[model samples]
Target: MALQILLQLIVTGLAWGSVYALIALGFVLIFKATDIFNFAQPELMMLGAYLSFTLITALKLPFLPAFLVTLVLMTVISSLLEMMVIRPLVGEPVLAVIMVTLGLANVIRGMTGLIWGYEELQFPKPFSAQPIMLFGAAINQAEIFTILATALLLVVFFIFFKYSRAGLSMRATAEDTSTAFLMGINVKRVFTASWAIASVVATIAGVLLATFTYLEPIMGHAGLKALPALILGGMDSVVGAILGGLIIGVAENLAGFYLEQYLGGGINEITAYVIVLIVMMVRPYGLFGTKEIERV
Candidate 1:
């Protein structure tokens, strides 16, 4: 019984963690590109999910078509936001930019509630809710799809960042924007591209989460939940986001199961933060993050 429950938790946690990893990836990408820790990412996740729901449920579109369209729409929105809001604020103080992101988050949140209503709604289930038997453990079908899709995106990004010209441009810009511009790269375009990429990732994560849980404006909270994953994985590492997400997910599940029995409920909610504190104490650079050397 114990072993079975443990396996169940692991599978479930991985699915949930994939969502966290994807959202965290958005945070990392934006931060790498612009050095801004976007607090609006989770709201973007919520917005993405709502967008999917609008395309499928309201517009009566097929799942695949809705999904594709949502990605495109998110990409456009993200780019436009970068051009209008982010670009204008370029060279501004970091604190001022952060305030913009925070304000943007609230604006997105209010817009979501205003458009979709404050009520919770059921999201379209793209996959069957059946559980498949794997090594005598029943794994959720949606979860299987979730992890597979996440892995596929990760692979795509790996190849993209490694081999593509635009990828090189992004890396160069991330390393040093002025230098990249000096080398003839369009730094503004790169920032827009980064936001578009993050938006697509957010759309996928939002869909996965909508599948995992019900749809609601409140679902955007998952974005905020991803911060700990970024901290755990290193704020700038892509693979670190995935690793941190899985670790946080599994730890949260385990804590909820075992620790809850002793500490009551809600330990899962705080488990990732706890891990962040403990891990930082031992490795301030995070599990996969590069430590910065500052000179006086």
Candidate 2:
């Protein structure tokens, strides 16, 4: 019985963690390309989910078509945002740019609330609700899908970054914008592509998350939960983000199950943050992050 409970928690946690990984990847991708920590990522995820909900429920589109359309729409929106809102701030102070991102987050949140209302809505499930038994643990089909989707995207992105021309250009730009431009890479286009890719990842994560949880303007708060993962994996490391997400997810589930009984019911809610705090103290750069030193 004890073993079964542990297995269940592990499986469930992985699913949740995979969603975190996807969202955190969005953070890493944009930062890698533009050196900007986008505080609006979560809100972007929320917007994507809301857009999906509208497409599926109101527009009566099929799941695959709706999903594809949502990706396209998100890509376009992110690119446009990069061009209009972020481009002007290119030479501005980092703090000022960050403030803009926070402002952008609020703008997205407010617009979502005005359009969708504050009432919680049920997101249409793309997969069956049936529980799949895996080694005596019952996992929701949607959860399984989330895991698979994350894996698939990871593989796709790995190939993209490893071999594709655009991917190589983005990588070069990430390494050094000045050098990349000297090499004839279009730095501006790379920035736009980075934002577009991040938006697509956010959309997938948001849609997967809403399948299991209630959809609301506040749903983007879940992105905050991924912050631990981002910090744990290293703010700038893609692989670190994935592993950090899984670790946080499993830790949260384990904490909820065993520690919650002794502490309180909300232990899981704060578990990731607590762990991140500890990690920050021990290794400020994160487990997989590279430490930088400045000679001043």
Candidate 3:
């Protein structure tokens, strides 16, 4: 019984962690490319899930088509947001940009509530409902699919960043926007593309989350949970985001499974924040972030 419970917790943690990681990746991606900390990522995820629900449930669109349409819509919205709001704020202080993101997050949350109402809504599963057996342990098919999908997306993203021309431009812009511009790269376009990609990732994460838990307005707050992963993985490291996410997910699950019995209440949610605090205190630059020296 003990072993079984432990395995169950591990599986649950990985599943939830992957979702958190996906959210964190959005933050990391935008931050890496544009140095903007987008607090609206979770809301973007919420928007994606709601959009999916609307297309499938209300508009009566087919599942695959709805999913594709949601992706395209999210990409467009992200690009527009960058061009309209974020672009104007270029060269602003980090705090200023972050504040804008925070405000945008709230705006999105409110709009989502207004459009979809406050009630929790279910999203249809894109995979089998049955749990799959793995090495004597049973895991939900949806969870497995989520993990696989995230991994695949991450790999595809990695390849794009490594080899694609647009990806190269993004990396150039990220390293030094002024230099990238001097080198003929369109820095503004890169920023817009970064946000668009982040939006797409957020949408996929939201959809997967809705598969596991019912969709709600507050679901965008999942971005808060992913913050620790961003910090741990380093603000500029994509792979670091993945690693940070897995760590947070595993730690939260273990904490909830082992410590919750003694401490009581929901420790998993609190665990990520605690981890972030500890990481910031110890390694301020994060695990993979470049060290910066402050002059006076």
Q: Best candidate per lDDT, number? A: 2
lDDT of 3 by residue, 7-100 (tens): 8778778877898899988998899898888989999999999999899988899878998999999999989999999988988998999999
Cα shift from native, residue 191, model 2 (Å): 0.4
The local distance difference test score of model 2 is: 0.93
Q: How many clashes would you count in candidate 3?
A: 0
Model 2 error, position 269 (Å): 0.9
Better of 1 and 3 by lDDT: 1
| Worst-scoring 10-residue span by lDDT in model 3 | 1-10
- Sort by lDDT, best first: 2, 1, 3
Ranking by TM-score: 2, 1, 3
Candidate 3 local distance difference test against the native:
0.88
What TM-score quantifies how close candidate 2 is to the native fold?
Answer: 0.98
Model 1 segments beyond 4 Å from truth?
Answer: none
Question: Residue 153 of candidate 3: its Cα lDDT?
Answer: 90
| lDDT of every model, 2 decimals | 0.90, 0.93, 0.88
Better of 2 and 3 by TM-score: 2
Error of 3 at 184 (Å): 0.9
TM-score for predicted model 1 compared with the true structure: 0.97
**Against the hidden reference, what TM-scores do the models get?**
0.97, 0.98, 0.95
List clashing residue pairs in candidate 2: none
